[model samples]
Target: MINIWAIGMVIALIVTTIIVSIMGKRATANTADFYLAGRKVGFFTNASAICGDYFSAASFLGVAAAVYASGLDGAWFAAGFGAAFVPVVLFMASPIRRFGEYTIPDFLFARYGQSHRARIIGVVMVQLISIFYLAPQMVGAGTTWNVLVGQGLFGLSPYATGVWVVVLIMTLYVALGGMKGTTWNQLIQFWVLFTAMILVVIMGIVNGVGYSDSVAKNSEKPLLNPGKVTVAKLMEGEPGKRLYDVNQKNMTPEAFAKVQAVVDKGDPTAEVNILVPQKNKLHPERAMMFNEPGHRYSALDQFSMVLALVLGTAGLPHVMNRYYTNPSGKSARFTTVWVLGFVALFYMMSQYVGAIARQIIPPEVAKDPELMKLTVDGLLLKADQVMPVMGKIFAGEFGLGYVAAGAFAAMFSTIGGLLMASAASWGHDIYENYVNPHAEEWKRVLVGKIAVVGMATLSLLVGLGIPAAGLDKAYPALIAMMVTWAFSVSASAFVPTLLASIWWKKTTEKGALAGMFSGGFGAIFFIVMNILKETKAVAPDSFFATLGTLTFPVLITVPLSFAVIFIVSITDKKLPANVEQIWMRIHGTAAERRERRMQQMVLQPEQK
Candidate 1:
């Protein structure tokens, strides 16, 4: 059954993109205009656009899904995400803009005495972080498509169809309109996502599914505990294993048996849910509170997750590029303030939506014949589907379509920004600097467009392969988890180097290079090891498992990166000769730089 309403929303998105592209085309004639929107973005407009880029599908769908699946631990993800802006405002924003670079790599190259090595490393790190970040947005796109359209096209799976369509649309949006178009589109997207979440919350409350009621109902049910379960095959001598969850042991033996019997008859390779006794057992009938911890993370994991989110935000390449779009340092600071406010509002509503979802569609109802038929595989809602399921329940099909549009907006807005960042890095940092140092403005812009298309195609191919790679199954609510790895890499590879370069005049190019390689590779290595362990290629209790868990490798890699940079800089005495001049450029006021330039201009005739 085709959904006319959903199709209408997609058409609306297409029309809006065309109009924005036309407008952006008028202003996008030079590199500055294309990459930074002429550096004239207003405070609120930039702020809103930053929110759109920052939120992504992880914030739109993943945060709520995390909350629904993991209780309070999920809410912490939102908190860390929101809190990250504080460090940006305090440490990065003003100086980054004052330095006045086209991209993060641009800043690094300038600060390191115009080294091509710095530029190349910066581009590599940017692409690494951007690609990791881009994948989740693609996954979210696919998940949204499956729930909304629920159909395949030309023999492609719904997931593949979504990835292809979104990538195609966003590639055009970035390649045609450039940064100006992406910023304007993001401004509109943020509001759409914000309003959709607000409406869901309001409707949920009006329908007697408010926060308090949600908490009450959630507390009355035993939480599902996930682990490996061995199942006996009907055929003798055959055995199988699966990931399954059994509820708290508070349930009576008879009740437990009934649930187990149902599970025994189901597919042994699939996830199964059963009831058991509660851990506390003090009040067997009373359930755990909604705010309780230990649902998903151990104490150590919680701390690690928070650490990754807080530090990672500072290092994200796409986000850092947005700060460069500000007209001045003051404007950049103001943008961060506004981003904090916007992010806080979104997260608060998102968690409430997650809680409301639990109330509207409880775990017990997951097995109901009618509800089962409505889900992806005639089973419980996937973690990413929590928010959409709530939409379908609270509103009708139209509501589902509306929310689906909002979800796509979230993915498209972020993807556009990411593609633009990647293009700028490739065109300006690599091509202009290395391939054609004397390239004209038009030539540079052409190269950027080509880079945009290339990067988008690469990301699309990777996104389409996610389901086939079994990533969606291994990490059920993959948005947050996959995003965290990106964050981990960013924080480990870039944060220490970025902070040191900005604040430490002693930082040498060698130190920065060493730190970037060590930190970036370390994070990637651990993340891959963790994934292998997750897929059961390695033993859980092995030493490698200790380093490779879903919890970020940031804790190890970040400090190691910092230490490497500090030690290398002190040991290598070959600092940039113009350290004082660069310091003034980065730390001095904009007015000072302007005055210096004017004075230099005034003395030029005498010197000649």
Candidate 2:
């Protein structure tokens, strides 16, 4: 009953984390060391850490799950996630590194003529985005825990137990080790998870699961989703048939018989979980097939979701913060390039893993009682469980152990970075600058540690509350869906203004403030309303109904923020007096050029 191999692997991971934290602890002596790892992380090391940080619960579990559950439409998550970094490399990476700031808010303050208003607004947006992003990781922790551990201690459910354990580990290590520890661990974490995924893909091919062949085989049947409907709704339709006919046509005999048994008892309120033909949400007139494109997004949403994923990468505070760790602008650019390649390969293999599970899981689910609870006629109840379940199917306990450890690495690495980012925004950006400008170095570091624990506590509470909010039931893979929402928020809140700040001299502090408020709050409002609509908490008609349908608001919010900043700056026309000087620094003009030349001169003299 106990999985000794799985437990052993987990213990090994924990031991490695502890060892890395101790190493980081010895290295961290000042705020600079704690937050940016002494600003000396190499391109390759930082690149690997960036992959670990970027590949959250959403990337690790959600990408493959999405492919498994929704077919080709789901592959867009990976495509969008990978494409996001391109803009970062072309637009943000070099300029941000050249700007030389500890956080996004720090950049905003200097760019906008040292306005506290801009700094404060930046902090608000950072924390808001971090919270939205962190919540999914918490939910993911619970979701993965349900599959790997399968049970809870004390009075907690399996989900809650997972959240608690992962959150505590993140808080402890991040607080103890700082960025130096986190960077090295992330570098290590990326490879562990990356290697595990490689093994799963290789093993699948060796076991007769070809990528093209597996996809073709799975697409042969009408794509069906296992869902529940009320008996009352099923009993309504036409003179001869009604709504009941639609479901009955798709349900298997065994599933239909179960529904009939409930109907015979005359219970209109009863619910039945039955397989229904998956509808093409994008093109309702088209058929829903596993290899097809219209399974999830509409014509409008396709573009909207793509924009959210692409622009959103530049906006993530935790991710943006990593750019500061680079020693130079060139290093930052190199890191982004490396990250793109690593994530692209990881995503490709993950989709194949999903396809293999699609072909293999159902047959095995019937034979294993433990696997039964995770699936419905071999289809996963929550698609996020695909990786570990597929692991067990592929190689029993040993395979499960490898994938489970990877899942843990994914969650811990990203969550740890988020915890550190939140700490820096609060402790370094706010407390160090405003709360105690004269505080000792020890006091400042202590505040950062305190912030880490506080964020970890908040994440734990969010983990427990996800199911209570009905978010778990509202989406097929909530881990991925929630993460996309966070991306939408960050893109809406940060990217437009950041671009304007670096490129346009007229981007006044007032304009930045107005833009942040409009875009940041607008994204959050749209996401909340959509969630409410999905959970059946709010019923909308006409205009509200159309707005509620938008799952990714970046299509509207990103442009709106850009427009607001442009119009407001034109009207205000109040540029900073030192605007030209700051421009040179940001764009590597005379000021930055002089600095670089002087640095080269000093090095040449030493060499002579």
Candidate 3:
């Protein structure tokens, strides 16, 4: 059970952390340095770091698991993730950097004419998104640890140990190095993930599992459809008990007639009546193709997911915070270009990895009939376990360690960024602005470090309860499903408000507040309803079901938020008189701002 290679990987990670800590210590002399890295990061470095921060366990493992389980639908998840950067580069990057603020809340306060209401709302949304986002990373950490170590320390479960280890490591890194250290660590983690994926793909090819052949083999069989329901009779003593013939709902008229004929001639004393698939012929003649839709989503769900991902990237605090580290607007724009390139390549490789995993690992039930009890439907016992299983299949024990190390790297980089973002919001936005307005620079840094520890501890406790909550089994790919909720909330709450603030001068403080509350609470409400329905606490045919069926809430919440803001802003007669000045500062070029500052300096001397 002991993995020597895994121990080596952990040692390597520790050594890298020490080196980055040393470098970060040199720069952590003040609040500005700790939070923004002195605003001196260049384009390529910042892009790489952003990739690390953005590609969480959701991207690294969940994408592969999704493809393995859902085929083309899973691939679309990766496509949406890669395509999200388009909107970020086209609309948000340069303008956000030009605003020149440390955090999103700072921008909100300034844009709304220094409104405390705007700042408080910004803090609430940021914390909500960050905390929700952090949970998946911790889940990923626990999953990887369960696979890699397969043992618990003392009385702790493997899952709990994994959560604690990752939380502790990330807390130390963020607390010591701040933004500068986290960025450097992220840069290194991204390459490690990229390289491991490439190696897996190469090994698969060398082992004679060509991409075309794997796709062909997988496409030959019918994809599993969870939505098609069938009816069966219950026994006398067993109330509400039913048996499911997964293929019965999808059968053609001819197939159904043949099945009915057999059922009609069979034993009449059977307790349950259902038509099952022929034991010898598991593959259906009419099956789903890899290029077709409806494998995992309806037309509405597909559009909703794509919309959330595309708009959500623009609103994520951890990703947007990286832009604030850039020296100028131009650097932020260039960094976005690099991020798109790197992320596209990563996603392309991940889809292929999923295909390869499916080809190499035969379902456990096929190998041992007894294992079916532990499996969902005799395919993958656990979808998240596919990556590590494939690693062991293609490269033995050492390969499992290498791939698991990459998985841990993915979690660490993402969690570090999330913790740093939370710290900035709590320490700078809330504590500094509200608690002690006259606090020194060193005191602010200490507060930020403390915030990082507090947030990490909270995330760890939440992660420890995830398995018991049955989240791991409810969704096909647990990390991706949870992450989609985070994205939906972020896109609905932040994207519309931020866009209006930048482009529409009529956006009043009251309008912004209404939009934020409507968008944030609306998404949360629907998400809770969905959970309730899933747990059977609410009836599927009830009113809550209508709101909960749609996995991505952005389709409803985003437009609703926009409408409220627009209506409220137009109705309110009060407007900030210096709106034009704030607009110029946000939209103006660097040269124009420099000239205005020089004029102010000269006029100040004359007035004195």
After superposition, candidate 3 runs with Cα above 4 Å error = 225-291, 363-378, 598-608
**Residue range 1-608, candidate 3, lDDT tens digits:** 65778768866976797589678977877878988999999999999899999889999888888887777777777888999999888878888899899999999898888888899889999989998899899889888888788778878988888998889888888898888988899999888877777778888888887766777887775565222122223112244322233434543454345445545655434332232222111123435565455555656777888888888888899999989999999999999999999989998888888876656765433454433322333345556766766666677777777888788888888888899889999999999999998999889999999999999988998898888777775666878878888888899999999888888889998898899899988988988887766666678899987777777788899999999999999999466777877877888887887887798799998999
Ranking by TM-score: 2, 1, 3
Using all chains and alpha carbons, the TM-scores for the candidates as numbered come to: 0.89, 0.94, 0.87
Query: lDDT for each of the candidates?
Result: 0.81, 0.86, 0.79
In angstroms, give how far residue 569 of model 2 lies from its true place.
1.2
- Candidate with best lDDT: 2
Report the C-alpha lDDT of model 2 over 500-555, residue by residue, as the tens digit. Answer: 99888889888888888899999999998888878888766645656778888988
TM-score: the better of candidates 1 and 2: 2
Which candidate model has the greater TM-score, 1 or 3? 1
The CA lDDT at 10 in model 1 is 67
TM-score quality measure for candidate 3: 0.87
